[model samples]
Target: MSPEEKPGGPPPPPPQAGRCRGARPQQQQQQPRRGGLLSEIRTAIRSEPFHLRYRLSPGRELGRGKFAVVKKCIQKDTEKEFAAKFMRKRRKGQDCRMEIIHEIAVLELAQCNPWVINLHEVYETATEMILVLEYAAGGEIFDQCVAEREEAFKEKDVKRLMKQILEGVSFLHRNNVVHLDLKPQNILLTSKSPLGDIKIVDFGLSRIMKSSEELREIMGTPEYVAPEILSYDPISTATDMWSIGVLAYVMLTGISPFLGDDKQETFLNISQMNVSYSGEDFDLISESAVDFIKTLLVKKPEDRATAEECLQHPWLEQSDEPISRAWNESAGGESSDVTQQDADSASEKSVDAEKTEEDESIVTEELIVVASYTLGQCRQSEKEKATEQKAISKRFKFEEPLLQEIPGEFIY
Candidate 1:
């Protein structure tokens, strides 16, 4: 199922046809009989035709969304693999090409950041715009969250991934861009068996935050959204920090901090700041990890730690000795006076062996089953809530100013 659609959620409202307010006479005359407006919009955007440079693989869909579908594609000349994200030019009888264009522009601006996904090029057709993006073979980090206990990320692993995520967020904040959405699904890994570097993807909801203006919008996956978002308050970089806190909690415990039985309940939980760190959910988690989450999950946005601050938190700075020693104790291994560096190297070697064993034991079918169960348990409610949230967003009429023209530097 598409991320936008939940198993039991209501279908999206149908489109209501409408006419554009302004159009040049000559352009209207040149418009074709069908999909004319979209064609003109595509021309103005100036993208190369997708079919000319790349060939999409049949039955190789990467993902799907309300107005977009991602498929695996290969560049003809270089035979390089890429994920082609085809976004519809129009949605619900309104021109949404600009939103796709905005995402492209954000990607362009973030091209220099190693943590962010690289956009190779763009392509356009009458009805769709395609983004050629770097492909991450390891898939979503969400998978690891749902993996078996033995295969799930340990404290040390989560620290490494969280640091990278923070680095990416810091880079975006430095660029004055706020990635409103920052959940596990959007964070991809380059490799899976031994894990790999982070590649942050899905910038469709991201916005350029200007200091002179307060950007406020009710758009994000419900479970990971900040309290300010629920209150319809001004959004800041702290909003993303709130999500990072929730993400860290989920990564460590595989349980959402504020999720409830339903959308209304979820919102209420967030509004009231209802959360728990007791019981078996956090039994194996470290106090420093819990403290790290607490520091960011504060009700007040300003009180939350900034991305840079989060990088320097004690939880992230904790050396490998404690975790390694704990692991040794748990596994009934003998303790020795090993140096921190030696401990980390031993821990890495041990984790790698475990990973290899786990990879060999877990079959693809079991993974699919685990993934399906995890999605049903964790993401179904999130998807249902997200669909309703999108509908509620329409009532706000939160429109961003359309860009007059694509910047020359941003053009691919």
Candidate 2:
């Protein structure tokens, strides 16, 4: 398989392209003299006649997707490295220049935020646009998810990473933007050995939410998609929270909560809110972490925890100290001090249990809505099948008489 087609590995270096002649002095004018998609793109991105290769040295391909390939590039002047993403203006014979422009706009909107990947510059060619973006050398956090047991992240590490993710997401929500796609693959790290900070990338599926408008689209990775998305409900900031919940689950257990054998089954699992906290997968995990996941995985978008709330959760707010072992060691015998601490812990547990029960009740109520929605879908599918069957029957009946009218030898 080609390097671009290969999955889950460091991409090889991209081949060098031919250099073009420099733009004339008159053509170097910064004004958007041209009209159409180029003009629209110029409104958000600075377009220059000079080629990107003129100022930057292209290196290895960092990653590749459906319509874009990111390659490592170094600035000739500053010697700084950047990820240059090359995106096609057209996909499947359809003009999608506007979609690329929208992504540029979203990046520009969140440019000031440090957690989101920064866009350095943009260059346009005849058929493709190149975006020089801040390079995150650590690669995707997804690698850690599937890493060997010894290389997996501890609970405290998960807390730190989650906190940064929540901060970035909160910034986006505050700006009235929703990153429809929030998965491990889109999240990058600045360093790998010490585990650097999170840099959320890929705004290709993000959208700006307006109070006067309702945005709805069936987009995003199926494993991380929310119930509202499957139901065709209006999109909101809560949509991103659901993905965060799924992300947290994966980081904690290295397993997806609602994934099934196939896409249809996976969709059904998400639509029906089919998730579990089995002991096998979550036994070593803390209760606070489980509670945080439960809070955000609610089927009702309105009930899911927001980014701000998630940041404030006890799990994320826990101290960075080593995991405590006093409670576990006390299994043999308890001193007066340990006994008192146990009483206090039990009291806190009681309160937490009460809150958990309330949350469970709320989820139970939401399950009714989910069941109704699923039933309606099944009914619709049955109706469509019956209608198709009737059409086929009518056609067969009409054709049977025509066959009878023909000679037996001709029919044979």
Candidate 3:
């Protein structure tokens, strides 16, 4: 059989166009054999103008999703690294294209603001739509805080990041946009120093709200989801505010105020604002910061502080005096006790050096493609697995409004 009909790899290249339709003369018997055809076929595929138009730069896969892959890519023309999302076309009966279109359209509309990850460009081929977006190097605020475990950022650092997040949300709200999902994962850092610079990313679930309309969709990560969202009530900027509070709580204490082993349990805990903070680990957190969290975690969406209001809150105010004086005396300096131990033992110092190297490697990799997670790579079971693995549990007494799921009739 002709190599063109072969089943493996790409089909062999078709014969060149200059052959006669009818059988050629005896001179045609001198035609080339098809054994060398595979190279030609591969060349054609690679040489297609569509493929030649862009070079896929080297970037480790940041994340894998069910329908797409998030890769860190640099635009050859601009030399600026961006997150390139490669989404495969749906098979016979699926309509993922529409979902992609919606995300792109919403992002395009919202890209006017600096807080949103700018959707730089969208390119389509027969099989995929490539979405290029700005890359935030410092990685997800979620991972950063979680990595801190017992010792996340101090109260002032938390306040600084929270204020910036609030400002970003306020900007979106003023533009009549609602980022239905506002968790720590969507918050990113552009800088890594003590003073962090943040930018909001991931608009996969963002929606533009009409001035007169209120949304009633239950979207967003469960822990940070607002009360109204769980109840199916109309959502507004308040929903985002609730999420901000959850983020603040997590960043300061390395523990969520809402505890649940699963989505159902987590939702329940969030509804009641049931929470516990480990003083042993979070001694550095200030009372004002904790109070702000209590106010925002109130089950009633109407009672929750708005982003603008949050910015005006006294706890968020800038002060020259250190809020945590202990931090001033102890934060990140040469400790004689620790140094003495390291110096006294060669093995101990070597181990410390190795750990530092590993940590630095992790940070370097994480900074390059923080936006590589695409929804297509996510599997239902895998998502459930992640939830199970990160399960947190505890309960606390509450004396305020409790969240309840809204009935369908009143949800909108």
The lDDT per prediction is: 0.64, 0.62, 0.54
Query: What's the best-to-worst order under TM-score?
Result: 1, 2, 3
Error (Å) of candidate 1 at residue 356 is 35
Q: Which regions of candidate 1 fall more than 4 Å away from where they truly are?
A: 1-48, 321-412
lDDT (10s digit) by residue, model 3, range 1-412? 1222122334211222212235232222112212110111101112133334456666467444445666777766667777777766663445445445545554544444455566766777777777777777766665555442223355667777887787667766654556666666667777555545777765555655544555567666666788788788887777777878887876765455675655678788777767665443345556677778877877787898877678778788856235441222356422233433444564454677775664443211111112223111111111122233343122111111122221000000
Runs in model 3 deviating more than 4 A are 1-53, 88-93, 149-151, 193-196, 211-214, 320-412
Candidate with better lDDT, 2 vs 3 = 2
TM-score of each: 0.70, 0.67, 0.65
Quickly count the clashes in candidate 2.
1
- Cα error, residue 160 of model 1, in Å, equals 0.5
Error of 3 at 67 (Å): 3.0
